[model samples]
Target: MNGAFSLLIPVYRGDDPAHFAKAFSSSVGEQTVKPAQVVLVQDGPVGDVLAAAIDHAVESSPVPVTRHRIEDNVGLARALDVGLTLCEHEIVARMDADDISLPERFARQLPVVEGGVDLVGTGMFEFLDDGGAIVARRVPRTGHDEISRYARFHDPFSHPTVMYRRSAVQRAGGYQPLGLMEDYWLFARMIDAGASVENIPDPLVMYRVGAGAYARRGGQAQWRSELELQRALRRIRFTSRWEYVRNVSVRGVYRFVPEGVRKIAYRRLIAKG
Candidate 1:
């Protein structure tokens, strides 16, 4: 891809501008490859302070920066669709408004672009409720065949950790509007399109599983979201059982095991192949 990597952060409901700016600086400032641009696509109305923070971030980025604010509140998948149209680079990586990308996130993935992989994801450090403490690290590794196998059963790439080729994403027809698991839908498509994917073996993103960020909003809406997710996965030809049980168990842990540790165990299985 030309000009290093392009980072896209989709904002909705006025995400913390200061945090976003810190994330931008953290991502680009410590990287050697240097990003081509950081595109801030606001999916919804952000507060004035956050808006100013975004502008400041755009202006201050050592690399190029672009900002696009939508008139209405578009969901994450559609927001990503809009941003993809504006990306000039062949490689596009994703960032969430509230999370932080590690210093080496970009530099580690940029050189691997030409290796014929359709997408590459990396390990993650999920933070605690306080954000000061890290709960666990999730690093996934598997050969091409095993990653594809895992994708059939579950999404192998953590959404924020992915660096995707524009053409590969386009060929998969881009993100689906699945509300709850849009990234998972897209990964299933990518695997069908002959896309090879694997996660770099180290924590490349610091994710604050912050309050009110979906998981915490666990009420009627969350339940319905999972119901919708089942239908969405079925559309891609995965068996219904795959969607509800195995996939669910494999994602973020279930019953008792911590999510990050579960991923490490799965990677061990993949590596044995």
Candidate 2:
């Protein structure tokens, strides 16, 4: 809990190898304010090739690098649970295996963390498939009051594009296994626990989207998670059944749209750069 920042990577072995290295170079490598520790935790079962890759990447990392390999595939939530426990710095920033963070991602974030804000997220440019190129640049904004007011509605920040204080996360009881989209659960819980949250207007990272994300979350599993989302929504305020359906329908359209047209629509209507 002493470093200016620590970058945590929770991997399940599906991330692009080059993307991992690029994340470090763009984020940890180029930052004027350096993170004290950069730890990569393999949440899934480690194999020979995966272990070798992580180790090789760590060897040349800009910041002090560390590695932890899980014995089994315990899902991403469990990976985060263990990762949070192992965070040994004051500021903890999350880095997805495939996404590339900007050079100033942490430097810009750390300066604004004063006062009682427990966490901060930033806008992102989507570095998705060739079809879309990039989607709308997303900039999330939710303060403590706004977060509490709309806890039942939607998530305020993109999960991976965030930096959190370790002490605050620990005080809030840490992360739990929330199935596939674990950050969704943690952010909801953080709001419930009275933590202040917000997102910087600047686009600080490149978030990747792909076809499989649609496939996995769209079918029955997404429906089940919708139930979970509804359940979480209920904890904040009572929404009518119609409200539930209406919200789900909107969320569904974004996912259910044909990928081809959807990509074009996103680029023209939303993609900033």
Candidate 3:
């Protein structure tokens, strides 16, 4: 109801301890409009060092911290599916363990949430290393109509920069374990379920990228995932036959392309420098 919201962050064994600390500090410790609670989800067993970092971050957080641990590592989508249940507020803000949430992220997003938008997401800057120079800015469509139109082709929201109402997410069937296409699939369903969504074009989170991010993005596994996603979209009536064909033709080939070529396509065609 009010601007109060819960910050949800999922951590896994693969996360860097140092990066997690910085992420926590930026998302919770230094927020201009603080969250009422922080829901930290440990997807699986982490190293002792990482566990200690989590403890330290929790102890240092300004708001009440609640942690949930899963017995096995279930990947991001499932982790978030479980994490969403632990959130205690109507509004929930998502943050990644390796990304930096700008100081005004909450200040800029909470008002939109309070104003009755079911979900709101913002653009993000991608960087290679810890707080390094930005390489690209991925900005999504800002209005509801544009977002709905864009969702037919690609994800209209940046996952880490989203703040959404819990009820709306649940009403849309929550998150599914859909490999790399989880966020895209979930958002499409949410839109179909009639959830009002909007995106702020300004970059609010600094997304961290690995050296091999582009190279790792494409492969047989990703190709299969993309194919399944397109089919799911068609099955759900989110994409017409023609749209599905177009998506498969365009997005599917990118998955199996050479690393250098894929990188060029992503940087030059998808992301804005």
**Estimated TM-score per prediction?**
0.84, 0.84, 0.97
Give the CA lDDT, 0 to 100, for residue 76 in model 3: 92
lDDT of 2 by residue, 58-100 (tens): 8877678777778888878777778777777778899887787
Q: Candidate order by lDDT, highest to lowest?
A: 3, 1, 2
Deviating ranges (above 4 Å) for candidate 1: 1-3, 129-131, 212-219, 240-273
The candidate maximizing TM-score is 3
**Residue 181 lDDT in candidate 3:** 85
lDDT tens digits, residue span 1-273, model 1: 354667888877657666777677777776666678878788878788888887787777788877888999978889999899888788888888767787767778876776767798887887754645876677675577877766665567788888989889989999778757789778878887788777787888887766543333344454455556655666666546645566555432421344455445644643222
Q: Cα miss at 71, model 3 (Å)?
A: 1.3
Question: Tens-digit lDDT track for model 3 on 22-106?
Answer: 8999998788889999999999899999999999998878899999999999899998989899998999999999999999999
Quick one: how many clashes does candidate 2 have? 1
TM-score of 1: 0.84
Question: What are the per-model C-alpha RMSD values against the true structure?
Answer: 4.4, 3.3, 1.1
Model 1 global lDDT (CA atoms, 0 to 1): 0.73
